[model samples]
Target chain A: MNKRILFAVIITVILCGLAQAKTTITWWQFWTDPNIKPVIEKMVTEFEQANPDIDIQLTDLTWANGHEKIVIAFGSKTGPDIVELGSDWIAEFAANNLLMDMSTQVASDSADYEGWGMATYDGKVFARPWILGTRVLFANRDLLTQAGYKENFIPLTFEQLNEATKKIQALSPSIYGWGSNAPEKHRLYKKFLPFFWSHGAKLFSDDGSMCLLASDSSIKALKVYKELHDSCGFVADQRGIEDAFLEGKIGFIISGDWLLKRIELENRKINLLSSFIPGTKLLGKSFQGGEFLAVNTASKHPREAMRFIQFITSPENQVKFCVANRSANPSSLEAQKDDYFSSSIHLQTFIRQIKFANHPPVDPDWVYIEQAIEEAVENALFRSGLVAHSLYEARKKIEKIKAQ
Target chain B: MKWSKAGALALALPWLLTFGIFWLFPIIYSFIIGFTDQQLLAADTQWVGFDNYRALLSDPDFLKSLKNTFIFVLGTIPLTTVIALGMALLIDKQFPGRGLFRSGFFLPSITSMVVIALIFTNLYQRGGYIALLSEMIGLSPPEHGFLYSGETALFSIMAMDVWMAVGYYMLIFLAGLKSIPRELYESAEINGAGKIRQFFSITLPLLKPVALFILVVNSIKSFQVFVEIFVMTKGKFETSTMVYFIYETGLTTKFEFGYASAAAYVLFVIIGVFALAQFLLFRRKQVAW
Candidate 1:
């Protein structure tokens, strides 16, 4: 009896140790959307289930906090085993040497991953493209109708939008014809980026030498932006876009699909429609504002981490991510063709916009420049009360940054 | 023989070492970086000498932010001092519900500034209550509260800060007021001094130390105002302050540690000069008695 009990005790100890044996992976992310959280949690669970030897912990932080937190973490050499980086963050993080080159891991089978090139730096891949969605004009058709604009009056060009806005303002029933956030960097930059690019303006000069903000095309783009603000009634704060649209007071908003679930949740009787915003000088230009999954250079289990990223980016799993979160599919050639995504009519507009995204200027200076430019632009508008001064001032500020 | 000094030093060693390694090194290192062309990821940093300082001297944004910081500090400190003293005097009374009122006053200061800024943002929105109230009163209320107006945005933030801080500062004043001997006031009454005269002669004179202490602390904190502008207008609407400028310069873009470090050192010097001037002026008054 004593011998048997000893053997059982030894067996139990071994089993317990096996249960505890796992490579713990730390992932930091910020997904506040109610739909997004569960989808991600499910993905994490499935990844864990498949690899019982690998344990993964997920943390959810807000967007603004996440930006600061990730930067601090990387600077301190204690970020995460993997992190979800916003598309805008690529330039900043890539510039800092915080991200690892994923090239070696995927070089053997690089074709398996699609658009992973988005995270490339100096010809080396760092992160896998996670999701793809673009900025679009959200037209509340009911609001348009109330404002005496036709249902099809969603403008096909910047000129058309202005014209439509003027018409709506004339017969408006407390409903403005158009609205866009002037002070928002992420939103405005993305919306204006395409216009600036298509209008033969490079936001940054070739070889990334100067801000080129004084370039004539950029000035024209700024003028167009000012016109949007002056012609379309701009709500001072962001909530004006979401609230006024819900109340059917705003005809159009330059926003993304991030608002879709909220609109559905509110259950407002207004007709919410999404479409590609017409370009000022070219085919509709949009920005892909999505997160990327990059493995930590400090990760103890790089092979396993890389494999996880690969598995997740697979067409099979990406569908899981997008469908569960109600987000656009990641920029995967395979994922784009998935019947589940292609058949979804509501998602088509976002999907179609994927091609037009002017790959963001990949420079280490973007995060700081973004903040400086945003502040400069807003001050020029609200403080100096002049667009030319604001853009020029913004250009000068960016120039100082670039020269550094 | 000097065990007390040794003991104190021993106890302080932990904090001293912590501050030395963490704060001192960074401060000095950043100052050195200020003299060079500092870039985080780049290995090369050519020495730039005083050029960064020279450029900063002429930078409008830097000057604007500095000006904004001073305006915010000036706008809040006096009002906070007087209002806090008034509240402290009221709370020192044995009046009914005094405890509740004290707690209520301290409530906003206890709440996070981020939450307050967020709530304030909503309040300042168009057709929001604050805006509506201004309109109803026939005021040319900035349609976006004070945040949208170039003329009033900075002051508006200062006003919110003062409102948030008065309660906290009041508690400090209340403590100082309580510590004062009641016998002194009684003697003043016996001497036939009026309430106003008694206040001027005793209360104001006695509260000098506390007032000076509050002024120094408030000035230092207000000088470093970043989050309010960062959150409210993101340093937009003419509300950008010195610290926010430092943040944008240093950590945010290209990590221009050199330029940002220069800006920071300038800020330190400005604060030091102000504090020193105040000390010299106040010390000459010889009011310790």
Candidate 2:
């Protein structure tokens, strides 16, 4: 009887020890949408099942307040092991040295994912890109045809777009040509920069020491944008503009992939078309932004966190996530060729635009620089018709930001 | 009834603790941080006494925000005070469904500002009801509607603020009106005073205290306008008020805590000055009356 009791005690001790051996890694993610939340949960559950020695704890975040929460968490040193960061926010955190250096860990697999420019800081990778997307010109083919254009009208050049919008505006007193963004900071820049870039306007010079916004190309681009705003543009916030488009009130709206999901969910029956942004020469360079995964410096379980990042960002898992998300594409190069993304025409347009899209300059001062660009756009749209003057002021502001 | 000092201290401890932790500490800490170069996420902070204040004095954005805040305060206060007073007078009359009218007027004040701002944003959109009404009246609205136009964005928000806030102040004026002695109006009527004359001589004078209180409170509230701008225009189209500027600098765009704190202190001073001036002006007018 004594020998049997001792054996039971030994087994209990071993079981307790084995349970304690499993490492728990906390992941803070921003996939709160009903459709995608389950996919994330399933993936995490599968990951834990596959790796018996690991446990995953997931926390949800919203796009509206996630950045502030993450900043406060890091400031207080209570951040989660793994965090999902917006592509633009990575540079700011990495510059502050708040992110763990994943250079050695991700070095081998870095080339597999796209948008590394946003995740790398000072020649070192700090985060892994997970999902990539870009803005596309969402048009109403019926509206174009009603305005006496071809049934499948898609503007190939800036002049064509301008004329198309004018013709569409002439269709009725209520109908509008374009859905232009109002002077909202952090957002208006995305709308204006595409026009500027398509005209070959580089934000900074080749050496990256001086502002190039005052160049001729930039002024020309601003003029095009100003004309759009003046002619038949239905100026409003992003949601308002998209709603107008969904209601078939506007001719064309430069919007993001999320609109596709919105259309599907709302079950809007309209003659819809998605195409590349109209450009001056080649196709316009739309804004590329995405989500990235990183291990916080405050994380106690860095190894486990890195492992989880790898598991979630694997090509197969990324494709599954993209399929669930319905709008965003997988960052994985291999996953980009998946049938799910290729099967949808709307996703195909976004994929092509993503290839041509340009991520804003990856710098610590990008937040401030983008504000300056936004102000310039606002000045051109509302304050004055002198696009050159607006560009000049923006260049001066950018110079000051760089100096600081 | 007398109480022991320890007992009293124990009773007050919860309030005192919360006050110190949430209010007093942040106030003092933010004031101190105003003189330093503290980034929200940066590990290190350095003292730069007077630099932030000096920079703000020359900052165009800061100046514009200050100007906008002042315009908001000045533009809304008189209009809101008169409209609320007029509303209170109408509601105070012995009329049918007076209680229903009072509740109807007070409903908007109780509603969330964010909800109202969002509703107003839609109402001010191009081809929205406002634009349609403008067309109906043959007074052509701006091409891009109200909120989207630089000329009308701030004014549109100001109009909404007044409409939402008038109800609360009207209730206050109603309370003030009820408190006035009925005997005084009886005496005025007996003296052969006309209704208009009695109102100006009796009601206006008696309502002085409430007016002063509302003016000071409204000035402070209007000067700190943020939610409407944040929701409607996002400080765009020259609608960046002082509070919105500080929020953008410290929390949203730049995360320059020190600069935002300095801007906040400046706003604090401005509000203090305005409040004091209103107090003095009201006191002198009371003496004249």
Which candidate comes out best when scored by DockQ?
A: 2
Q: B187 in model 1: Cα distance from truth in Å?
A: 7.0
For model 2, how does the per-residue alpha-carbon lDDT over A233-258 read when each residue is reduced to its tens digit?
A: 88777887898888888998998888
Write candidate 1's Cα lDDT for A1-404 as tens digits.
99999999999999999888999888888776776678778778888998888888888778656776776677667889888888777766766666787878777756744555467777888887877777767877765676576666657787877777766666654657667564764555665566666566776766777777767877776677666666656555565677777777777777766676566667767687777767764466776666788887777888888877776677777887777666765666677777766665557777777666666666676765666556645654455446566667778778887775
In model 2, where do residues sit more than 4 Å from their true spots? A1-15, B285-289
Each prediction's whole-model lDDT (CA): 0.75, 0.89
Indicate the docking level reached by candidate 1: acceptable
Q: Which run of 10 residues does model 2 chain A get worst, by summed lDDT? A: A321-330
How much lDDT does candidate 1 score? 0.75
User: TM-score of model 2's chain A, to 2 decimals?
Assistant: 0.95
